[model samples]
Target chain A: MIQLDHITWNVSGRTILEGVTVAIPANTYAVLMGSTGCGKTTLLEILCGLRQPTSGRVSLDGVDVTDLEPRERGIGYVPQDLALFPGLRVREQIGFAPKLRGMAPEELNQRVNRLSEQFGIAHLLDRLPDMLSGGEKQRVALARALAARPKLLLLDEPLSALDESMRAEAVSLLQRVQQEHSLTVLHVTHSSSEAAALGTLHLRMVAGRLEVESKG
Target chain B: MRLNRSNLCWLVLALITVSYLVFWALLLVATATYSTPDSWLQVLRSPEIRHATFLSLVTCSLAAGFALLLAVPVGYLMTRLEFRGKSWLDAALDIPIILPPLVVGLCLLIFFQTKVGKVIELAIPFTYQVSGVVLAQFVVAAAFAIRTMRGTFQHLSARPEDVALTLGCTRFQALWHVALPAARRGMVAAFCIAWARSLGEFGPILVFAGATRMKTEVLPTTVWLELSVGNLEAAVAVSLFMVLLAVLVLVAVRATGEKV
Candidate 1:
């Protein structure tokens, strides 16, 4: 579960998110819909610990993670740009977190192989991010994020850069993966169609406040 | 009868490009032609020239290494951090790059006479020494390295590092694993720029380290010393040798396959 209690983020004496509060249940696919420049990304960033809320609490899996670093929060993030490490190959990128955590070499290899196979990027393990297509890069980014096995996954406009066909494919992939892993996801997008397609719990943002639209 | 504006623009650009290329070519050709092959060999093989050559190589390498050591962290900080007086700090860092080389050397010379500098000198000598050559070179070279590295870091997106941070890595680990590797080509370019700048540095070394043959004399100081005594042949020979070394350094860097 992910919870934001009375979250308010002010920048330069202007509020980006004001008195915002919401709860996303575990294993729920929560789509946060808002117009451009409506603080959707900022809200996601706050939840991921990339940005701090001015006055509020962020809880993940019933633990208060407001003061915790991103790594300590046990959250996976895919930024809008799909910021894959330019220097690392797909395999290395996927295995990066586990390697940092001192996972045994055999276990790391097994995990990487499993994720690659599951994400259908096994053939691209040796390729760099630049060599991959947009959809392939998306898959690699998703696989890389999930390799760490975080309690919550936060994606900021992950499908915004893809074409219609690629978006459909990515939406199906995300849905299947979330179901298979029972992953709690908070996906920020401005597209209502995307919200309708993938969200188990729908939430909307208006003028920095969150309103729960529907619950599954 | 009349050229179009686009054609005129192309003509002017091409003329300037060719003129610059020809100027550099003529300078190399004149230097190479001024000295006889035998004199070139003799100048290169001479004991004093050999010592100066070795010292130049050693000092320039040290200067470049030191420059990189200072540049990486400074560049990263300048690019990644936002603080009060950041603009002022940025301008301050450019002082070494913009200051006249002779003035920089003079400052170094005067600084050693100060109390803090005297205390530092007691532990490690820099005035009128080979170390002083490196110090002079580094002061100038590090600025260029820092500028290059700052530009390098600026061109890189912060998102990768942010992603790394969320992936069970601390800030330092993210820097080590993600930022450094991404900046590898930039770092190499910075090192080469610093190394080449150090090799060609003359005014600072001349003013600070002094032109002592077979001791503190670097390639630039060697050129100055040879020219001072009316040894034009030896001076030109050393100049051409410096050119050759610069080309070889560039070639070696390219061979290392650090292309982005």
Candidate 2:
């Protein structure tokens, strides 16, 4: 479970997120919709510890994690840019976090292989991110985020850059991944189609205020 | 090969680039013609030339190594961190690059005259010593390396590091595994530029380290010394050596997949 208690964030005296409070249960795919600059990404950053709220407390599983670093917060984050490392191959990028956490070689390799197969990027294991297409990079980025097996996943506009054909495929792929992994996911997007497809808990943001639209 | 306007533009640019290459080729040819095998052997066998060559290699390498060590942290700080006076600090980093090398050497000379300098000199005196040559070279070369490295970091997106942090690695681990590896080509370019600059540094070393024979002399100072004593052939020989060294460094940088 994740709780954002009165999370208010301001930068340079301008409010980006104003007293936003929300609670998300485990295994719920929460979809957040907001127009450009409506604090969707800001909220994700705050949740993942990339940025801090001016005044708020974040509790995860009944424990306050407001003061913890991103690495210690036990969350997986994928930004809008995908940020796939250019130097690392697809396999290395997928296994990066787990390798950093000292997972054994055979286990890490097996995990990478399994994720690659699930993501349909097993053939691109030796290729760099720059060589991967938009959809391929998206899959690799998702695999990388899941490599560490975090309890929560934060994605910011993951499929927005893909073509229509790729977007439909990705929507199904993401839905399957979320259900199969039982991952608590907070996905931010401006597209209603994406929100409707994957959102178990639908929320909307208007001028820094969050409103609950529907719950499944 | 047509006489069209676009072809004319291409021809002009090609000629300009070729002209530059020809100028360098002509200089190498002139130096080779002037320096006979016997004269080359004589210059190579001379104790003073040999000592200067060895000292130049040692000091320039140390300076470049030290510059790299300083550049990595400074570049990362300048790129990743924002604090009060960050813009001011960024502008201040260019002072050494823009200031005259002789002025930089003069500033160092003046610095060592102060009370703080006296204390530092007690431990490691740098005025008119071989270490002074390294210091002089490092002061200027580090500025260039820092500039190059900062540009490198600026071109790279910070999102990868952010992702790494969200994963399981600490900040330092993120930098080591992701950032540094991404910056490898830039690092090679910076080091090569700094090394070449250090090798050719003259004004600062001449002002601070002094162009003494068999002492603090590097290749550039060796040329000046040889020329001053009416050894034009020897000076040309040293000049050719410097040119060859520069070309070697450039080739190495290119081999590492970075354009000069």
Candidate 3:
């Protein structure tokens, strides 16, 4: 499980996330829905070790990884921008994490091939990021993050960049990948429809606290 | 009536721009004969000229390379982190760039003249030595390199490194594979400009290193020495070579620009 306990995060001496406690159980997808400036991305950053909270703890799989580096937590996060390396070809971008973890070349190649096929991105493996369409780039980013088989996957506004038709395709791709990897996902988005479609648990960020919202 | 006004504005702008451009072009290029066959042969055959050119190439390349290597981390620190003295550090990195080259040279000379320079020399000396030229060049060129690299790091999204860290890459590895790859073109532009700055460094080499012939002379210093000794042809020859090198760098600059 991925858990946050009484987490308090302040930026520039102002509280952003305070006394937030939550758990994302294994193999379950949770959606965090809120209005803009609600600190959803900041929460994801804290979980992925991109940002450090002012106080409190983040735990993954029963171990406190609050102070650990992002790489040590076995958690994966895709940011709003997708953060694709612009100079690299799609295949290299997707294989980047595996390469860093020092996986064997044969294993990496096999993993890249398998994920590429799974995401319907086998044809885009050789193209650089600037050449790829928005949807293609999003798939590459997701594929790159998933190639490591992270214990917890964090998706931030993953469908915001896609057109209507592409979003339909991507929602299916996302569900399939989450199920196939057996990942516990905490997807943060502003869209209620997206939340309803993919998430079984709904939480809202209000006044820097996580609360179960009534959908009346 | 509207077309007449627009056409008149366009004609005046074109005329003024073309006139200035043609004048500047002729000043630099009309001297094609200034780069004579005999001077080329003379420069090639003269051991002093050859030695100066080689020394310039070696010292400038080394200084530029070292500056770039060091600037990557320092620039990262100044740009990406928030320390107690971050604003001060940012301002400090920029002081050298804005200081007149001659002033920077004098400051460095004083630095070497003091106890701090003495202690540093005990570690890695730069007092009237061959290494002094490199030291001088690095001081000036690194200022430019740091500025360039700071921008290179700024052009980066910063999210890639964040993602790489999440994906199990160490900070250094993330810098190498993710941010650096995305920053490839900027780094190349920085390298070219820094090297060019090193080659053109005259004030620091002259003041701190004393422009010793065959030992401390780079292209700019060689040009000065030639002019002092009344060898205008050789001075022009050296200047011509410097111009050619600058052209090569600008071509690289333009190519890199188009790539990004």
**What fnat does each of the candidate structures reach?**
0.82, 0.89, 0.89
lDDT of each residue in B143-222, candidate 3, tens digit only: 78788778878877788889889888888888888877776777787778878888989987898888888888788998
Candidate 3 chain A: worst-modelled 10 consecutive residues by lDDT: A207-216
Q: Highest DockQ among the candidates is held by which one?
A: 1
Candidate 1 deviant stretches above 4 angstroms: B249-260
- Model 2 chain A weakest lDDT span, ten residues long: A44-53
The sequence of per-residue lDDT tens digits that candidate 1 reaches over residues B69-117 is 9999999999998889999999999999889999999999999999999
Alpha carbon deviation, residue B188, candidate 2 (Å): 0.7
Chain A only, candidate 1, TM-score: 0.98
Root-mean-square deviation of each candidate, in angstroms? 2.2, 2.8, 2.8
lDDT of each: 0.91, 0.91, 0.85
> Who wins the TM-score comparison?
1
Cα lDDT tens digits, model 2, A110-203, are: 9999999999999999998889999999999999999989889999999989999989999999999998888999999989899998999999
Candidate 2, residue B187: the lDDT equals 90
- Model 1 residue B112 CA deviation (Å) reads 2.1
What is the DockQ score of candidate 1, to 2 decimals?
Answer: 0.86
Superposition error at B73 for model 3 (Å): 1.2
Cα deviation at B12, candidate 2, in Å, is 8.2
